[model samples]
Target: MRYGTLDWVPALDRPDLLAAPVTEALASWAQAAPDAVRQVLVAEIDPDQADTADMTATYDLPLEASANCVLVAGKRTGEERIAAAVVRATTRADVNSAVKKLLDVRKASFLPMDRAVADSQMEYGGITPIGLPAGYRVLLDTRTSAGPAIIGSGIRGSKILLPGEVLAELPGAEIVAGLATEIAA
Candidate 1:
């Protein structure tokens, strides 16, 4: 199915009808990034989604990548604010060291599945940085903003393509550098 300039199976308008979980996610993303057109692609089970998939191998490709970050409003141990950082597949978000310091939180952790889904209003595998609450902080990796990149659309089965700048316009979105780095294989 094609919506706008991008082409993929299981259109975003009918995510409930799609059979693949990832496809549904991608469809939702397409709707979110209507301007990105033709940059997003829906593939089979991404290696990143597989527990056994090699991180090094997965990072080497040009796939739609989104990073999960925990944000806190204060410098307390129990305060946990979860946010998603979308970036290119080649890079990983600097959650523990950099993002943690930026949010001024005592600690930052990767959002667990249940909490991520609930907080972002996205399916387990389909959380994007867009369509989040206005107050929730969404930090975009520099690489993602440099060009057109694929990102999640609050679902798990699909991805959408759009210029990274558009993602910054989403509510509570901020652009930051050093959010991601390539892990040496």
Candidate 2:
């Protein structure tokens, strides 16, 4: 299948395009929602263009069609709470308010890049909600699940394309309205 000038193949058919954990989680997704998982596709790309901005420019993909996943964490009474915030590239996650409130933490901030990569076992620029730790919440902004989107494949060398419906159905996914603030033009 081709989407936005990129050749996309069923992710399950080409595990090499996904990170190890993404591959594993995708298998689980297949079992839970065969049809949805079947819609998930992957396309290899240059590692240097893995970030949302670069990917959009290089591939002629609309920023609004791209989903950016950010890892956020906060400490509450000695326990650590973490989540992956999935929002459109045209907006930023409301971590300071929506996410913090959701986690019931006094404060919330992006997890350090190194820690996020290590904890998620995914590349920094290619972090996606699909294969995060089971305990990590997947906070999917409502906008992301409203249409087709391009998201990380859990690695820097490829990207996944799927409908918003598929992302909304990920295990542990929580769709939140007002979860993001649109960026100014």
- TM-scores, each model vs. reference: 0.63, 0.98
lDDT of each: 0.53, 0.92
Model 1 global lDDT (CA atoms, 0 to 1): 0.53
Per-residue lDDT of candidate 1, residues 93-170 (tens digit): 777776777777777777666766666666655555555655567787777775555555445444544556655555
Clashes of each: 14, 0
lDDT of 2 by residue, 21-116 (tens): 999999988987999999999999999999888899998889889999999999999999999899999999999999999999999999999899
Candidate 2 local Cα displacement, residue 97, angstroms:
0.7
- For model 1 the TM-score comes to 0.63
lDDT of 2 at 169: 89
Lowest lDDT block of 10, candidate 2: 1-10
Off by over 4 Å in 2: none
**The best candidate in terms of lDDT:** 2
- Residue 53 CA error for candidate 1 (Å)? 7.4
